[model samples]
Target chain A: MKHRGCGKDLAKVSEFIDGGLPAAMCRRIRAHMDDCRPCRDFVASLRRAMALHRAQGRAPSPPPLAKAELRDALRSCTAALKKRKPR
Target chain B: MPESESALISRSREGDPAAFESLVRRYEDRIYRLAKNVCAGAPAEADDVYQETFLTAFKKLRTFRGGSGLGTWLYRIASNLCFMRLRSNKRRPFVAALDLPSGEGLRLPADSIPTPEQAAGKRELAEAVARALKLLPVDYRLVLTLRDVEGLSNEETAKVLKVSVAAVKSRLHRGRLFMRERLAALSEGAA
Candidate 1:
């Protein structure tokens, strides 16, 4: 994992990791990472993050505000309007 | 989707609580996800965003002049709520340091994040990824999550974010790179 690479180098590795690159470029990145410990580490990092995302998605649900609550609020508001009306 | 939601909105605007409830039921899951992703690892904040979004939408429904689709309008409200919450400088504990809620499967629990054990040894890894996402700016954050995680198509994502498809591609490209770099960093620590 003791390898060095730039953000440009990352562009190659990046596209490869995302499956966004063409076949030829993908082959090149694979060859590059195979020999480059640093790039290998970088790829590993990306995969690990993806693994975490796969695991920890959508945890809490919104507490139900309750239909009755919404209804009650609307009713109260309506009553307020009625009382304020000039008949 | 347009006709159905609009029909619901129309009924809701007519003061039908049931119709409005149907609209809420229809959009709640989506609205929640939009808030969570936009806030990026801050569920409590995300919760606030969600509450504000729905509340605002309810108040403003009468003003909807039928210009945009209803979901798009709801998305506009939810996104606005997220922006305010994120920009508030509240100093809440970063979600990176805490437990993400728990569960597995797409349906998801109402109040739990999927633990890695639930996902089998991948929980920490996922949290790291989410944290990296938090590091990204909001422009990137909104499009990336809405597109990749939520699986919206380029066109739909563009519509919600109100950007061009080309802009979506550009942002997503750059955002993915940012994420991959973060992923690279997190995995380095894991190893």
Candidate 2:
């Protein structure tokens, strides 16, 4: 039986990239990709977009002031912990 | 030199303030960034979430049973705080659902680091991406950011979001399609 058509495989491209499907399902998607040009292109572009987000959206390091604030906050937190009895 | 996370955890469990501070220093940037993305680029809200995450984590550190990695545990805390804050606050309205192509089959180049010129385009693309992402619901945005942008594995993402792996996969697929459609449009407009 045909597990899925190109339409179904198109939806599975991200899942394919993610290794979310079982091996047999993955093989069906690969077989579909071999025959379907549009699905392949969509997968490629989808990958490129994901790549762009990962490469460009690298969060800048937390600002120094924020670090200082965290330091102060943690200090106070630990101080509070010291005052309280351990659970 | 910094103490190892386990060593620090041990000390902190014994109520050592300095050791707890060490743990905070180790994870502050990462936790902050997760909060930033979960807040959909809202710095103020991200800041609040960051603060709340650490506060809760510290208080609850005694209960951490080492079943998951520290980062994952901390992220779970941050994720909850971000969603909590989002629920309480009014969010800016967002437009979702554009006519996206169902498929386009072509093998693109494999992953490569962007060069300087491509980097400029990437910055523009990042802005467009952020705009597109903001249009999605909070659950979709959170899954996309954690799995796609932040490179969390499906299991790790599921744990952090308190969803099952199947749920993470579903949200991730839909979210990626939503993003791809918008980013393609933005690229065509720029070209």
Candidate 3:
């Protein structure tokens, strides 16, 4: 597996970082990293950056819609819909 | 917050203010996050997008054909509002995609607030990421924000954005690549 991992070395780095590689490929990357400093650094940094980006990507907690705001918006929305209804 | 989509939709359709409130309670967080991502984290713009998304959804309730889940449908509306807001504001695109590994999206970090001293650093990183996302085109920004940030799947994103699954993937890949580049640059700059 290490000898014949994904043909593209660098892409395999990214793939391995992402866990996108198949099990055999993962084994290969693991073996390759045991001796590959540059690839290892790339993977480590890529992992960190990915961790940050993904952290920021989490669904944000929405600002609570106060009872007043919801009621008000609903009233207006309903009014608009009724106003547009065909007589 | 509304407990169920159907219940919320039905109540909202009937002009039941309490039901509408419940809907907001249920989905406001997801909607705001989607809005925040689409609007590039501009508090003012996010607010507008958020307000307009729900208002528009409420007004259009009677016409909803039940073709999809309400949250996904609302996401479509929120993304649209984000696009319109961005266009109107003439904001630039977001270009940050720090190339990460796959299955990465599934490992969200647990929430924690920094101490007062660390708040600045945490916020700076957050803002830098936001600034990079600002470089994406409106379509890419809206789609990635909804799909990646908001945790919607490709099919759901496609349905909401009214695009085919292939289009969603294409946009997502492109947006993520762009985001990675920006994030890498930001890290280098900070270093």
Structure candidate 2, residue pairs in collision = A37-B105, A38-B104, A38-B105, A40-B105, A40-B106, A41-B104, A41-B105, A41-B106, A42-B104
- Kindly list the per-residue Cα lDDT of model 2 for residues B77-137, writing each as its tens digit: 8877767777643254544332335433312223579788766765666567668766777
- Residue B46 shift from truth in candidate 1, angstroms: 1.0
DockQ of candidate 1 relative to the true structure: 0.24
Candidate of highest lDDT:
2
The candidate maximizing TM-score is: 2
- DockQ for each numbered candidate: 0.24, 0.41, 0.27
Q: Model 2 residue B126 lDDT?
A: 59
Docking class of 1: acceptable
- Runs of candidate 3 with Cα error greater than 4 angstroms are A1-44, A57-70, A79-87, B1-3, B88-115
**Ranking of predictions according to DockQ:** 2, 3, 1
Chain A TM-scores, candidates in order:
0.58, 0.72, 0.62
Relative to the unseen true structure, what is the Cα RMSD of model 2?
A: 4.5
Task: Give candidate 2's error at residue A72 in angstroms.
Answer: 1.3
Kindly list the per-residue Cα lDDT of model 1 for residues B31-74, writing each as its tens digit. 77777777776767777766666667776888987777777788
Q: After superposition, which runs of candidate 2 have C-alpha atoms over 4 Å from their true positions?
A: A1-4, A83-87, B88-120
Candidate 1 whole-model C-alpha lDDT, 0 to 1: 0.62
